[model samples]
Target: MAHYLPTIGFGEWVTTVGEVVHFTGYERPLDTLKLADPRDVKLGHLLGTADMIAQMADRCYLEKCRDRLYPEFVLGGVALPLSANGDRAIKYASGLDLLRQTPEFMMETRKKRLDQTFNQAYRYIEPLFDGTNPYLDAIERSLDFLKQVLRSESWRLLRRNPQVFAAQPDSMTNVRGLMVGYFKKVWSPD
Candidate 1:
């Protein structure tokens, strides 16, 4: 049960903690998202989250990129507002596709324009190193949990953010194996 969402809405969720949210100036989300409600932004942002979306695309490509991808589960069901802590990605499906079609395949497939979506995403996530960045931490934790699931059960993401579930191995076995390595060293160390 995947949610096919468009652009995100604005002011639906508090972007930051202890901050006042003003949607009266709700022009940005209206302008950016197509058929979007600010409330749905959280859902959209969840989809936009790097590991989440990357895994989304990977799930889409599970059969194709299985050897290259890991797996992911569905996102939130109950409508949650967007957080300034949106774990947005650079456009995941596209990025994972790039990974699958690298070394000139995608470049040649497209109009010769460099697709830096994943790189752009990587750049956005650069600020996660030092302190407690909720967004970065979310991805980190999700990845951590994902790795654990991978090592222990070879499962996929059932849900992310507040809820994480592992079911079937969807796609991206290569990525799954990478995650397994992480769990082998990090969480399940014994």
Candidate 2:
């Protein structure tokens, strides 16, 4: 199962602005950071990118983690200590209650965050019920857009319907093995 944390994490250092700038890895040569031109990456944008990535990743991970860690999550395996900057603190709000305290998007109030005729009714909850969420839809659309161009496609479905492949009575085989095992207990005849 995907693990959910109330806290948000970004990229895959998964990452942070700090990690992105000073990253050392088996794939991307670490030694090159010093020599390479950090162009195409502004200092501000790096932080924003890390923050945006963390938020999006955190949001995705939340659902995958199955709400067991609801209202509190850690992105990219990051702790994001309480004392971290606004960029980081926003990354750590365990509850929407403290969303104001979170440093994301300069939002100081939930009212501002949900600025619509019906905040809870329309902006937030409606889409979730109808499978039209901005965050999720964005990810799916982007993936589809990218896959069309990339020669080799690596499709992955966590805990949802699989539309790409042909249906089979043994759809369980398409899911994770552990989930299949769980289903055996709950779905099998007593």
Candidate 3:
């Protein structure tokens, strides 16, 4: 059986580690004299961690992007377009609907947002890791994988029969899980 991380609240775990390790970030006092030499303290940057990124790449990131976060963005009136009368017109009922209408556009939009978010976070908390950022590469690979899945026949089938797809017992518990299984079957990673 494959393990999957929760889509939300994982960042808190990372933050907790930083707190315990006495990292420079996360509200630690800058003016106080350090008991231990700052040079000796190796800050563990979670942003580009390999295991986290791999798990994210496996499903969490994609699931969040497809089902929860994207839908929230659309529903929250952030991505809605204005009507001719200057009122907000909902173009798509949900993120799934948006994807169904324009899969390519939605995929591109999601990818662009992911890039922007990751880059912004990296800039904010400059990682001290000497080696290359594995998370970025993983994100790119995952996005590519997601794009391929979006274009797959299984995705089309799901879109065509959204109600039926949603009605399945597995999907009833977690639609994202169902979709992930479908994606795994449809698009074998290289």
Candidate topping lDDT: 3
CA deviation > 4 Å runs, candidate 2: 1-36, 40-94, 103-190
| Segments in model 3 whose C-alpha atoms lie over 4 Å from true places | 1-59, 91-93, 97-130, 156-190
Candidate 1 colliding pairs: 14-84, 15-84, 48-89, 62-171, 66-173, 69-172, 69-173, 70-172, 73-157
- Native-to-model Cα distance after best TM-score fit, residue 172 in candidate 3, in Å: 12
Across 27-139, the per-residue lDDT of candidate 3 in tens digits comes to 45423324343332222222323223444544345454445545455434444656679765656555555544444553453354323322333333336555455555555
| Rank by lDDT (best first) | 3, 1, 2
Name the lDDT value of residue 112 in candidate 1: 24
- lDDT, residue 175, model 3: 47
* lDDT on C-alpha atoms for all candidate structures: 0.34, 0.34, 0.44
Q: How much lDDT does candidate 1 score?
A: 0.34
**Every model's TM-score:** 0.21, 0.21, 0.36
Return the top candidate by TM-score: 3
lDDT of 3 at 189: 56
